[model samples]
Target chain A: MSDSVVLSLAEADSLAREVLEAWGLAPDHAAAVAATMVAGERDGCTSHGLYRLLVATASVEKGVVNPAAVPEVSEPAPALVRVDGKGGFAQLPFSKGLPLLVEKAKAKGIAAMALNNSVHFAALWPEVEALAAEGLVALAFTPNHAWVAPAGGTKPVFGTNPLAFAWPRPGREPFVFDFATTVIARGDIELHRRAGKPVPEDWGYDAQGNPTTDAKSVLDGAMRTFGGHKGSALAAMIELIAGPLIGDMTSAQSIAVDAGRGGSPLGGELIIAIDPAGFLGDRVDEYLAHGETMFAAIEGQGARLPGTRRLAARRESLAKGLAIPAAFHAEILDLLQKGKDHVPNPPQGSRAGSNGAGDGSGGH
Target chain B: MSDSVVLSLAEADSLAREVLEAWGLAPDHAAAVAATMVAGERDGCTSHGLYRLLVATASVEKGVVNPAAVPEVSEPAPALVRVDGKGGFAQLPFSKGLPLLVEKAKAKGIAAMALNNSVHFAALWPEVEALAAEGLVALAFTPNHAWVAPAGGTKPVFGTNPLAFAWPRPGREPFVFDFATTVIARGDIELHRRAGKPVPEDWGYDAQGNPTTDAKSVLDGAMRTFGGHKGSALAAMIELIAGPLIGDMTSAQSIAVDAGRGGSPLGGELIIAIDPAGFLGDRVDEYLAHGETMFAAIEGQGARLPGTRRLAARRESLAKGLAIPAAFHAEILDLLQKGKDHVPNPPQGSRAGSNGAGDGSGGH
Candidate 1:
């Protein structure tokens, strides 16, 4: 196994933020990005955590992402919202607009927000889980760069196209789940490749359309949808709903438009929020009770809830510290040093490792 | 093979309506139920078609489904509506209230209708397809009696929770897809049992939680969710949203409440409609064009769209006829004959096979 190191959540967050700051990102943008990365690591999603910092830095350096862009949001109708990310990171617009979305849904029973011109590369759970924490039911869909093939099709025509859903359980953590339409996430395949391991046969197909167990072949070819045609239909649904419905590039369009940039695909995301209180009135508790019964039954049968592992990981990580690869830690530290050279004097209290132990609360 | 008879679309519709009428349903309810049954046959969904007539009749006979009850619709908010099924079949309320739902959604950008106290045994596509026909995007979810086990669990904790989505494709038939979260639908398992065929290993499990290919074992035990944990999460989501959110009996509650009824489970359904015109304005056409490009790309790779097979079956059934088993035909005829003894004076034109060669258009 490769050498690894454990960093406190505070240290990880501070280091990530300082690196982004050195890359010329605005304070708020850097903080938002850093928080998401830290949360990913906290939830045991190493692929979506600090590993993405390199790609994000490269994106900003190559002029593909505007580190200083301000997202603009407009209400087209009582229950309709449009947010233009202005070719910036998705977290910026989502952070700025999601509270407004929750308010609108509360006022109108339900609301839909379309986020366009954004680069989204984080785990989807945080956004929906945030809404659920606000006592609302939320569903979110986003299309990424094309990597999954349609069922029975050899060519990649759809993005991994992840979807997230969350339902509030009142005083408890929300019942949250996020998954890509593919049999497994691209990150899992990448991990397998990095570990020099073979994936399962159902994971993906070779370029010639024959099923293969080689993780490298899957990366070179395409991933297959889960459960045959059902997952394919779901991916297609997400592609249309999150893509063209928001007036952003579909998976195919994203490939065509971003071919020269070699950056992560920029597209739109669709989030629909429903205020249960508005519709169910005081009966929301009864609704939650029914959900409890389901959970109890599932537990009695020895089944874990969808987000159980993540929640467990989060608790452990918060209590201890995030175990990250030693080499990866060194790389981020190097980036931080170079970033300091570019920015010269860092902002007050913005230095890496300054926030010892962190608050270990909120922003998850 | 069992003996069978082929009946034209019109003849099939007329026969189904007359059978329901003879069974003491009001004319409108009979028509609505018959339309759905005929649609099921037209789309090659034999399990939901005439094959289900016996169960419908039994439910009505046992008073589990009130054949004479009237559905009530009330708008709780501008964007929210509630339909009380009054313990009747789902078709009555859905057929009566969905048009209003379309109008409300178009005027308000989005709308939701909670359908409670209804027995939704038919396929969900018809309801969402109706909305798509009116140039709207629609999502529908319904929970049934507990049949599917959650991932890693030995007991059934969820229904074969079905979800349907439809998108308007403008000049062509709407793009519609409906599927249960289970690896296979209960009806397909029944068909396998009837045909004395063994299912695939992933289809279901025995009562002891061991994987099995025996259809009888699955029926006696539980169905497995498709796509492993992801599908389980989806089923759980549908159970919560369609069950508790609508204040109806959840899968477990339905099983408890209906234990003595020996009839189809009754629950709630949640339908959400979105009007592209209200949100996207004239760009609706552009949105559809993008969908077309996706379809073209998928087809280029030798992949068929989700609803392709169903649409083809519908066209063929409309042009030629629906071939149904002779034993099932006789059983329906016998039920109709027995029903005639209960209701002496049938309405004018309420006779089996009377509406021959009816106009082969619309509805679907």
Candidate 2:
């Protein structure tokens, strides 16, 4: 632990936007990417924030991410929309297509958006939360390069596949959560390794298929699904639903096709939106009240609701500023300078211990 | 352990149906209930099989379950159907409405069935499996009486809500799984208590808000969700979606309203069906092939698919016989005799160690 640099939220967002702009991304695209990263940072999700920019920039330089790519959306069914990300960032497709998805759901009671050929690097909660804010129940699932082993398996056969869900509470803040099927996300393991901490025995295994507590060994081997078979089953479901169901790469396929681009895997995401009011009519209010009662009961019983802590952190960051490691801040400044010079090369060793590919921040 | 009696599946089904018929249930209604129970036994889910019959029959006798009730289906939206169960077994409504649901999904790419005022006692997998067998991707959720504590909470505030998912794999058994949000179902804990065995540390807590391994304390206090907060959040989502969203009772509400009827709680279920072929067109077979590849990889890695064991048990039971406790078999026979005598009273001490209001087998 060392002294950190405190940058106001606006300053962080502007700086991130400028860096992406310098890399030749369209202003709007840069803004979307910056907003996602800044939100992650504001919520204390450091792995999905500024920590990922260098790798993302490097990925752009390597042509793994098309800077000028535009998503193409099509309605295959009245309640189903498909967006081909065209090798661009996932945020672009989601941002451009979610409105239509929400509209369809509002009109049809339920709708689905399948996003394919996208590179997902940010946390998944933002997209789901966005949908929830529109007064809809939202669920999102995405697969990544295989890094987790299925239950009782020795090798990695699935991604730290992430699932996100959000429920709107009308006037109150929405309840949102995003979690990886793995017992612990890769970023958490990276942090533990950096801190020389031992992970739980069930978190992962060694190369030889034996359970290991060492974070470093687990990283080199494979992460284990949380809750054993239950979590693994969920991971598999995501792989099927978000991958092949959406005409994108499965985790195994992603691993086979992805080059060492030092960025997130190019894959797909499946998002579902359900309009509660459309289905429940006036009864929606009663549903919200029930949720409130449950929340109050949980709090009274000394438990915190999901997303409460993250929302608190976000509020605090908005009021004050984001805390960034001093060294990381210096590195960002260096990257800024390089960006000014039109140098697209990501600094070597900038992301030590990161699997040449991105850490799959969507799972974080 | 005592030796068990094995009865052919047909014999079990006929016996269950006869008992229900003698209790004044219509032949068709009795047949539906018997089929569900027999399927549970055939799949090795004894908790939901003959073990639940006494409570179910008692419910009919107490008027908690309307044996002659028929569900009314109304289409509120093109892709959404609301089914009023009219206070009866869930299977009846599902049996009547699933074809319509499947038809709607095929026409619109996705459809949802909101079933309210239903008593769901059988395992949820069967419903989702039926939909999957029709070449659809299906998800089912239901809430029960409050028995599980939210993460970090000291008291039970949510049900051991169960979620089931199924994916069709053409020409093969569908991939289907149903799991309770709690670490283990209440029946399992009751079994542990009866056997004088301790549960895992993470399984539950004592009334004093301290973690306890004693199954009896867990039974009296609260059952913790599996995977801590993640599972708890899922339970909460189910409560919102399946309860209030369907114009039914939330778990806490159900607990407050339900009398000691020695039966499964009267609640609601949410079923969603998606037509992959409708959305993906000719690409579905390719998707199925990808799933097979992933399954092969998982098997090669020494991992078993989630539903393999259940499917195997079902096949075996259909071929051989259903293994059941001799005492339970004799009890069912005795109940049949009582039914023949027009005795509406549930046998005294029929349920061992149940908390007077049944074990909420919705989670089983």
lDDT string for model 1 (A112-195, tens) is: 888777777788899999899899899999988878899988788899998899998868889999999999888789889999
Error of 2 at B224 (Å): 1.0
Candidate 2, residues B1-364, lDDT tens digits: the string is 2667888988899999999888866687788888988888888787788776787777777666767666778777778887776667778878888888999898888889887777777789989999998999999999988888999896988988999999998788899989999998888999899999999988888887789999999987899899888888889889988886666777877666555544677778899888887556777787677888888989997789988888898899988898787888889999888888875543222222222112223222
Q: What share of the true interface contacts does each candidate keep?
A: 0.64, 0.69
Clashing pairs in 2: none
Query: What's the lDDT for all of these models?
Result: 0.81, 0.80
Best candidate (score: DockQ): 2
Candidate 1 scores a chain A TM-score of 0.89
Per-chain TM-score (chain B), model 1: 0.90
Query: Which runs in model 1 stand beyond 4 Å of their true positions?
Result: A1-8, A323-326, A341-364, B1-6, B325-327, B343-364
